[model samples]
Target: MSGETIYKGNKKILGLTTLSFFLTFVVWFNMAPFTSTIKEALNLSKEEIGVLMSINIALTIPARIIIGMLVDRFGPRKVYSSLLIVMSIPCFIFAFGTSFMQLFIARAFLGIIGAGFVIGIRMVSEWFPAKQVGLAEGIYGGWGNFGSAAAAFTLPTIALFIGGENGWRYAIALSGLLCLIYGFVYYRSVQDTPSGKVYERPKRNGAMEVTSYKSMAGLIFMTLPLYGILGLLTWKLSNTSLINSSLANTIYVILAVIYLYNVYKIWNVNKEHLKEGVDKKEQYSFRQVAILDFAYLITFGSELAVVSMLPMFFEETFELNIAQAGMVAASFAFMNLVARPGGGWLSDKFGRKKTLMILLLCLSVAYMGMSQINSSWPLVLAIILTMTCSFFVQAGEGSVFAMVPLVKKRLTGQVAGMVGAYGNVGGVLFLTVLSFVNPSLFFMTIGVAALLCFIASLFLKEPDTAEHSSIVVQDKAGKEAAM
Candidate 1:
């Protein structure tokens, strides 16, 4: 579709999908804004509160991977709508829970909704061509991501408006209700692709299809780190006495088994291709996907970690009140509204590889500057530095996905899924680093990681946009046709 046609013809789809993503995020992060209130009401310890927060993200690591496959198999429209509808159950459970276990189980279940972001990656890609996809995906992502800030800004006021100790409960439940209703609206409003276009399904659904044996090895090597991050999370919980040594060991064993099973799936899917070799035109490098994975790990990972801690960092460093600190910290997230789309626009105008490398370099430098902030620095200067850093960080995220759809059309959902999962892996890894070091050191760690990703991004191969192909077609007699 032409750019103007997209605005006129596909605008409704874009609007509805973006709103669906926004509502899912609101439900996914509903608890974060009211953590203190919940902690007070339950008489929970700091360790218990930490577990509750950790539980919010734990399942998302795997959920993104699973949802990616589902999107590819069932199509984004159905998968996304089903996710929102089903996840609302946990949201309601968490809203009413009076005990720690109830709250913990419900919060963990809510993590499944976090996978909603990957679904729209495929949906927006289906609607927009390679030339326009970066900007389209950026708008979907940048606007949808604002849901977290929306919850933070409005949910507390909503609770106050309800006026009672159970006010937080009602406010949380309201998000669930909105999510439940929007699920139906989204199902009715959107289709998997534009008119007369066939949705491409991956030949093998369980694991990504790699082009070569070397790439297969790289994919396996990369998969290990995801499991390692889970292991680290388990260790962290064990260290905090959240679980016993025996349970941690059992979880470790489970992860190892899952990893082995994934390897089998990868082999099962790609073994035939390894023997016969894929068509040169059909093959793309897994190295490109790996580099993007690392880039997102640093960009989105730091964003999640910084957003979680920046308010406290401001409060501690500037001796500002909690309210002032929170408002200042919020500027980081607020940058997503424009900066992400700007990054995507730059990627489309310039070359994708060049745009990504520049953003990563700027991100590394911005974080380095942030590492030097202290009590003596002006508060205005601190906020400026934070927002400046945020722009590059979020824009880097936009650039990463700008190329995602271009990688392999059929595997776009799975590719987006694995890359998106790495983002959560980065969050868990960076936040764990924060637990060991002070704020300044934590900032330095992120800066160092970004610098490394910049070097890795130098190896990325730009997606070929010389000719855009339509999806495979089927004839009336069940014969396959190429576009």
Candidate 2:
């Protein structure tokens, strides 16, 4: 195919996949905007409401890991479309749910929809050449991520226009309906890759293949935080009295056993390969993935944490009305549409490592500025700083993913999965910190973490090839050989 034809075809696939991602996000976070409405309708206690919020993210961490594996083994077309169609059931369930138990179950299941983000990383990487992959991934991510904001802004009005006690229910269900319709539309409209390009699956599927025992050990070390964050979530629920002490302890034990089993799976998958030794061409550093994990832990992780609280911060610090504060807070997320893509473009035009380092360093400084915001400071100035801080935070996220696909072609889904899971881990950890400290201290904590990530970024290696268009073909015996 000519370059021009490939470019034109890519635009269509990118748009379709990004739209799938956007609609999933819309359904994933649909409950958030209706928090108060649901509470009032259900006559729920504050603690129950808190539990609802907590469980909504509980499944997402593991879902991303599982979805990543599935995307690699099957293909994004099947996995993503199935994800959208299946998740819509939970969305509909939550929409009509009247009791805390019902809503809680629905929302918890809906968390799996968040895994849709990882599928797109693989899909976009497959379609766009390396030179343009960063910007393309950014557009997919940055635009799709806007769905949450879109839900927040549009859903309430949708409810009001429908105008009834069940208006919120109808509004939320509409998001579910979008998912249902789009699931079929997306499956029909897109392919796993362009017409001539073969979709590659990982050689092994249970766990990521590690080139060295050291890398295996590193994988085990990193897996700890994922389960540890789940433990933290359990602890939080225990404190809220959502789960009793005995139940929480039981959950803790179960989590530990599961973690150990996961470690065994990782070892089991990689042991043979490590014993024989991988060919030099196939060997890539686990350290690279580890670095990206922490980098995301700082960038997207902080964005999740700050977005949750910035409205309350503005409302209290400036004494603005709720509506006024929300509009101001929206500015932070508003940067995603531009800054994330700009970050990727920079990574493409400049260097990935250099762009990420600059963004993280500036992110640290921006948070330091945020940490100092007070009632004495003018609100306009504070909002300006907030937007600036958001630009770096989001752009850094774009930069991180821009390099994700380049790490290894076959492992893109699994790699994106682990890194994306860390972002949530960061969110949970940072929010836990917020629960213990003042807002200023929370900002300072993230600022300090960003500084550490900046130091880590210094070690990121650049991808050798600027474009990954080399073809991989399979012979009759079913072995892949790159051409």
Candidate 3:
């Protein structure tokens, strides 16, 4: 019940949940390093490869929203476990994928697994008290996010050891094995919260409930990016530089209809709740969620996009070997363990708004350093820029989640899902931008986005009280609660 004891409980469960959540991400992006072999095996065109990469993230647009609801309804245990075991099937299928469509389908299914991060957001909230939740959530995010880097390090080596033209298959299969094992271990070892921690379930099922018409409009406005990012995916498919025009057109139509239908569905589901008379229930201010979403879109989103491309930038510019490039690029993620937790701790000791602004300013300077890179520059200087960029990149990540749990209690998972998805949305958006621009522009674009986030943070209202009293549905969880 005490803050320190609650954090101890949170730390224990977050550590375990982070393991499960991370495996899905590891296997999700495993294709990055192995794409060359896959393209050769399938005799695929460059356009097909682009489409293949795009498909891997295609389904996650809807999956995050749905998984958030499910975690809120059923708790993260069943959802997280089932996600792992189920994702492994695709990992294996992808390993042996003989045709382009086969790999595409498998990768698309894998996208849903990214939503695994959201479920743990709520789980972490239940275990930690308000004051410490930011640092707790940062650990969940920073550690779990490293799974991608793990895939970068170990997966290719596993493929090489298998020793064949089809070595990539062995690598992917090894990832599948990890998924299968972690699934059971997570299910068996972890509880949604400590035995003494309370689990809060949200009041409604379909969409986020808003307290007033003005906020409802704001909610609608916020969802526009979720759909717009999906539209970007469709546009990539249709682009002649990427995929076949005919198929892209079909996919575009499908995506457009899906977005429209999602808006309609969420509007209908929450229509009654949106009415002022239905409930005077207040959620986190629309402004807060919006600010956080933009912050994450810049911070986490930049990390995702930059990481995806860093290896290539190094290899081409400095003429480093692929392995060397990957190692250097991956040093950015190394900051995750310390920087993310440091961000949260700083926000707790200082103030959330001040901490976020400082990090955002640091990020702007970091981008300036990154933009200066050229073939003539010393490699050490480049590494310093990367490490410097990484500190702000990860510290900003820490600050965002530090604010997440304090919003509304029960909806932490959904809130986290939207924010997390925006990170992916940022990935898709920034990557798409890369398709049009140069690498320097890439760094500059992120710098501009971070500046926007800095301005947005000024609009955020800090939580003045320890708890925001919203109705938490008392089920079996209430009995176990230390609170």
TM-score of every prediction relative to native: 0.96, 0.97, 0.91
Report how far residue 109 has shifted in candidate 3, in Å: 0.7
Task: Name the runs in model 2 displaced over 4 angstroms.
Answer: 1-8, 473-483
Instruction: Tell me which residue pairs clash in candidate 3.
Output: 134-402, 196-482
Per-model tally of clashing residue pairs = 0, 0, 2
What is the alpha-carbon lDDT of model 2 when measured against the actual structure?
A: 0.91
Please write out the lDDT profile of model 3 over residues 173-260, one tens digit for every residue.
8888888988888888777765444567777777876666676677778888887777777776666565567877777687778767
Runs off by more than 4 Å, candidate 1: 1-8, 469-483
Candidate scoring better on TM-score of 1 and 3:
1
TM-score sort, best first:
2, 1, 3
Reference-based lDDT, each prediction: 0.90, 0.91, 0.80
What lDDT does candidate 2 reach at residue 12?
Answer: 90
TM-score, candidate number 2: 0.97
- The predictions' CA RMSDs to the true structure, in order, are 1.9, 1.7, 2.9
